[model samples]
Structure formats: C-alpha cells, structure tokens
Target: MKVITTSTQTWQAKLAGLLLLCTPLINACTDPSDIGLKLDPEANRIGVFYAEIPLSAYLVATDSLNTTNAGVLVAGGDISDYFGETEATAYSRMAFSTSATKPENEAILDSAKFSLEIGSLTAEDLDETKTFAAHKLTEPILDTAYYNFDQLGFEETPFASGSFMLEENSDTVVFMNIDEALATDLFTKIKDEDPVFDDIFSFRDYFPGFALKGSPSQQTTLHVNPGTNTGFKLYYRNSEEDTISSVYTIYTSSSRHFNGVTNNPTGTPTEIVTEKNKAYDVGALVGSKALLGHLVKLDMEPLSNFLDTLDNVIFNRATLSMGPTENFPDSKMPIQGLIQYFTDDSNKILRREEDNAPYSVQLGTVLQTMTDEDGNVVPAVTSGGTNPLVFNTSEYIYGPANTREGITSYVDALYRTDVMRTDLLLYPAVVSTSGTSIITSSSITRSLREYVVNQNSITLKIYYSKLR
Candidate 1:
C-alpha cells in the first residue's frame, strides 16, 4: 500500500481554499426547504466509494490487567449460560497512620469490625442472596505492582463470613464483625511488640492484608468504593472504668490492591481456547461470542490504494461499518465496542494516554432499535439499515496527509510499509479515565456475529474538493 505525493505547497493551499468554499454550499443545501441555491457537483469534484477489503479477526484472553487507583473494588460471580462463567475477588493492603502510638498494657481489647461502602449492583442481582467471606492474606500486598489475574496466597481459615440479600438493603454500607479470636491475636501482637502503628510498610509486615472473596453463584457483581467507607476498625478500652473507648481504623487505600477476575468457559459450547493463529477469518459463530474477545482486523491496503490515485484531495468523511448477521436480544448484546491497534507483545488493551496519536475508537451503543408496524420494538437488521458498529476513520486516514509536508512524509512512510499500515483491532470497550487506570467490567458479556462487507454494504462516504 502506497500514497503518491506529487503536488506542491501552492497547489495544496489552493485545495484548502476550495474546501472552505464547498463546506458552506454543502451545509446550506442539506435541508430540503433551503435548497434554492444551485451547486455544481462536477465543479466541486466530490466523490464517494464503498471500500472493499479483507478483514482478519479472532479472540484473545485479557489477563493480568492492571488495577491501580481504580476507585472501586469489584467482587462477585456471574455466569452466562451461552458463554461461560466469571468470578471476581478483591485484595487490598490496609494502611494505618505511622504517627499513632500503640495501645498501652492497661487498654482492654474489645471488638473489631470491617465495612465496605457499596457503590452499585446490577439489575439482575437485586433479587438474589449472596455470601462473602474474608480471608487472612499470607503475603504482603506490594504497593508497586499487582494485576487482576494475580493469585495471592492466603490462610485457609476465614476471618469473617456474612450473607446478605440485595433486596433487603436500602443502605449503601455493608458491615461484618471480625472473629474475636483474630482480634485477640492482633491485640496480643500490638501489646507485645509496642510497634509503631504509623507507616504502611511496618503495618503490612505485622498484618499482611485481607482478601474479600464472594461465594460462587450466578448473580450480579458489586462495585465498592475503596477510598472511603472501607476499612478495619479495632475498638479497645483504656481501663474498666473508662467511659469512652479508643478506636483505630486501618484504611484500604489505593496504594497496593487489585481485583482478580477469572472467566471460565467450561460448559459453553464455544469454549474459549487459545488461538494458535492470529490471522484468520472471523466467522459468524466466532463473532457471536465477542465476550470471549473475538476481534476483526481491518486491512488498510484498500484505503491506501484509493488515496494513491488522488491528488490535492481534501477528505470530508471516511467511515467503516460492521453489523451482526442476526438481531440479538438487548440483554445479550453489548452496548459498546472498541477499535484499537493490535500488537502481539502484550494482551492488555492500550489506553489513549500511552499512545502519541489516538489509536483507539469507542463505538458507542451499536444496536439501533425501531418499532414495527404492530408497535413492537426490535433490533434493526434490514437491508439498507444502520450497522451495529460504525467507525469514522477520516481523522486517522486523512489527517496525517492533510498538509503538503505531511503528505510527502506520509507517502515516504507508506512506501516503506513501516509507518503506514491499515491493520486495526476490534474488541470490547474498556474504560480509562484521566487519573485512574483502565477498568474492565467482569459482569457484562457482549456477543454478536461477524460483519461482512460487499458492494451493497455501507460504504466509506468521502466528500472532497479536487484542485482544478
């Protein structure tokens, strides 16, 4: 694939001027009522074409996801009868103030409690009962590194266990009493060592951490606020006659913690297995199992060939459309999808922050619904209908070669086949905010069929003004 650059700066400047002239004419005459102004299509020299190309796609596992400063701690179990099962567990290293002094020998250890502030619950989970257990971590929670698939060692004995029905709770906070024996052991250690209670480093050495695991059940997962309303509190008395007892809280900070999520495709007919080959046609069956990470890789050779024949062309729009073979139920369909550059080195999805140019595009709300003649609403899958996923590649395709210098540089890179390659990756959308790390939900499962493009398929509509 190559782009030819033969025009000079003066010719490129004239083309830019022509583009401004065409913009107002196109926008003003778009409405039927305001179509009095006559516009010459031949003089404008605008053209449109349905770009035909081959696409290679497949599914890949996303393991060892980074979960630093994710704000919410995830824990729950969800099973998809058609796909597979998913379970999530949260681990955190609690921190206490280093400046705080240890309790005196006269202080009598009372009770201990652990609480978590629930953020959200899925609609399906509200009716069912779920049980959760806390275990004593055997190793320290490293502040520097951790992953979503990490399996940290923990004691077999549970610190506390509790069950709650989602419907019965209106409050956002969930509380559980820690075992008295565990509290007594901690009290004894604190009194004997008289250790500094302030720093996280020393605190973790004495008390490694805790792992909150949910019982395996096909229910909704939970998102709990780790920054606030999550901690371990130990209550004690200075003396037998003391009126007010002293309380110390170890907060579950964002320092060192991760949510471990495992997706098990045991019972599903289309079991998620490792793909030995990367370049393979994504069939209808494979595309329907998108939750298993089935992806479609678009080859950019067709687009590059189209650009090579044009000179002093200003691209208005270039879009790629993809759709499922059959209309899927709303519950089974994924609301969003992601398009990114695939690399073989790592399985984790790269964020916009990591790239120089925006290499990822989020296709929001793919399914379009319409009411039938009988007043029943359903997914749109008719001829000449909108695609489930559409990507506007105008900026990515044209923006690089907009200027004369950019065109020359782009053409040189294209010929080398080093800088200008048209292979793109499609996957399930994962969110990454300004200050927080990327977050992938374990509860949602998106499944759809492969999109096939032909001459009648939704074409790449490009509006441009060719320099005379």
Candidate 2:
C-alpha cells in the first residue's frame, strides 16, 4: 500500500515554537575549556541508558460489526486456539430483471441448482470438506444495513443440503441441487405469466431469499464469493422434440446480503485474557496457547525521572525493544503486528489528514539475533536472549521538542501529552484502505504473543548528548 504524506501546517507551527523555548537551556551548559577538560569532538559525547517496565493488556470483544459491503463473504466453522470456536453463515437475496417473453405453456422444468464460487483459502483449509444446508428465509433481506451478529429468521427445514470437498491447490465452485418441487413451482409461475413474475419486488414477495449455513461439524472455514459468481440457475425445455435447452438465472447482489459470524470463546486463550484481572502474559507461548490481542501501557514516569537526573541533555534517538520469551519459538510467531493508541474507552487514535490526504508513521517488524555459545548466529530464543520487538521511539519522544514549522506535522505532536502512562493496542496487522476513523473488523485478528519478563521485560534504549 502507498503511504500518504500530507499533514496540517498549523499543528507543525505550534510544535516548532515549543521546541525553540527549550534551546536556551541547552546552550546554557558550562564550556568544557573553562573546566580545563580536554574532550574529543566525537568521543563519548552521547550517553546511553536502558530500562524495562511492567506491561498490562486485555482483550476486547466487538460483536456488532457491519459486514454489508465487505468484499468477500465468509462461511464455515473453525476452532482457534486463541478465540475458541467460530461459525459463520451467509444469507443472500437473489433477484433477476427480465424483458424476455414467458416460456411456452408446455415447457418442462428439468432442474435447478445453487452454486457458489470459492475465493481464497487459508493453510488450515487444505483438503477440507464442508457440509452446507440452504434454508428458505422467512423474512425479507431488506436493502438496509446489517451486521455480523444479526440473526435473520429462516425456515426450520432446509430446502437443499450437500457437502463440498475442497481439492488441494484448486479453487472449485460448489453446486447443490434445489428441491425439484420448488423448481417446478417457479417454472409454472414464469410460464403462466403470473403477476408475481412481472417485477423484482413482486418476485421477492413470492421467494424472499435463501440462507446458506455451514454444518456444525465443519473443521475448516471457506471464503464464498456470492456477489460475483454465485446464483441460482433453472434448466427447462420448450418441447421434447426441441434439441437445445433454455436456462434462467438469478444472481445475488451485495446490496441486500449479510454474513453472520459468531465467536465463542468458551475455552480458548481469549477466555483467559478476558477473564484475568491482572497484567496479561503476551508473547509467543501465550499466543500459541490462545490467540489474544494486547493492550500495552508505557510507564513514562520512570523515563521522565531518568531525564531529570541528567543536566543540559539533548536527546538524539530512543528505541523501545521487546521480544518473545526465552522459551517461545519463532515458527509459531505472527509475521506482522499493528500498534495504535487508545483515545477513550471506545475510540482510538487515527492517522492525521489534511485535505483528505492521510499522513502517519509506518511500523516495521524487527527480529532479534545473537551469537550462540558455538559462535553461530541465530534468532535469540534461549535464556539471556534479547526480545525481537524493537520500535523507534524518537519521534514519540524528542520529535515534539524539535519540530520543523512545515516539515514536521503529524510526527511532531504524536506524543505531546504529559500523561504519565499511555495505553497502546497491539493486534495482528490487518490492512485497510477505507480511511475510516474507527477500527473495524478488517483491522482486527486473533494473533498471540508473550513478551520477555523481569530483567528482560520491556526496555528503552536512549542515546543523547550532554551539551557540555
């Protein structure tokens, strides 16, 4: 994804003025020559320090997610170590706008089938077989918005039921034959030119929609693209002597369709993270045992005290480092993560924008490496190993004190607040391009982590000049 680099000029000017006020104190330090001190221009002028503080985190559940315009429709069931079991069912109201004349009175309806095109699949879904049951919806799927938790009423008896076996490395379409009696009814109505078949509105009154649900025994989930290549097709013949057969199709549209997902955290890691009252255990082990999101709070009071102990200081760079525990393995670790700050109980900080263009700092993944006793370099995962998590905190710390009038906008005021503690959320890095202010389901996932503790809990490495 392309990064946006636009910012607010007014915010930058305010930050720059604050930095100017701190310059005089830095220049007031005593000269080295007056003290008869012979100091090398580039030798040991910068001081470095490291500190680790305790962390706290918790999992938050967001059930009422609007999935009406989501790109892909998801269906099936899966059990996650971190989130317990989740089952998803998709409902679509299909329609057809026709101008062709009705078929002959003697036309015979042969068959009707419902088909869905499979999109992408996860590694866990390889060679999977999922059983699905299609039920007739009791209520109309209105053109209005719907959420993931919305429960639409449907008939108790399924009109069609079948199982689809997923092939390895193949994107195959699944088809299920509809009840023959239902097909005959639709054929007769269309052939007889019934008033119900005249328009889409009347057509829906006779046939509301179908609700496709995954069987409870499913082990893996599947992505079903109902908007594009999904629909119901009916085959018929005008006469027995005629050679070719005719078909009528009805397609599912995105306007009145919804995907319902239910997350059951009964015995998963999410249960532990949500039920526990104390600080959370975040790292690879905790992540593997159960997928969980983290709420990391930075203890900034100690950092402020450390800065007060020094005189005439000019900060150069600050790096925050954290990694998996010594026993946590790298194979099970999540490849990417997202970090953001909370604004209130329900809101979160967002990228700064100017004239609709967004500007924000991008976070990258860092791996920790160390030399073993045998002198071979490898990932630091043993006792006395360093954590792999490292983030540059310079912009969040010193940037506010040296902001440029126009050049420094979003980055400068990132951490201008004087709060002693700041809470940051950590989750699997799911990408979004919609530019919405609130965090949606598209940006949340069930990833796990367990950071190093005690002496190696979480550390800040700061390098600064004494301004002698």
Q: Please name the candidate that would achieve the greatest lDDT relative to the true structure.
A: 1
Candidate with top TM-score is 2
- Name the runs in model 2 displaced over 4 angstroms: 1-43, 46-56, 100-103, 123-125, 167-170, 272-341, 345-422, 426-468
Question: Backbone collision count in every prediction?
Answer: 4, 12
Please give, for residues 104-164, the per-residue lDDT of candidate 1 as tens digits. Answer: 7878977787877776543254455567778889987775656555768898877877677
Cα lDDT of model 2 overall? Answer: 0.47
Reference-based TM-score, model 2: 0.60
- The 0-to-1 C-alpha lDDT of every candidate, in the order given, reads 0.48, 0.47
**Clash count in backbone of candidate 1:** 4
Alpha carbon lDDT of residue 206, candidate 2? Answer: 88
**Alpha-carbon TM-score of each model against the true structure:** 0.58, 0.60
lDDT of 2 by residue, 22-84 (tens): 112111112222211223534322222112222333344333446664555556655655446
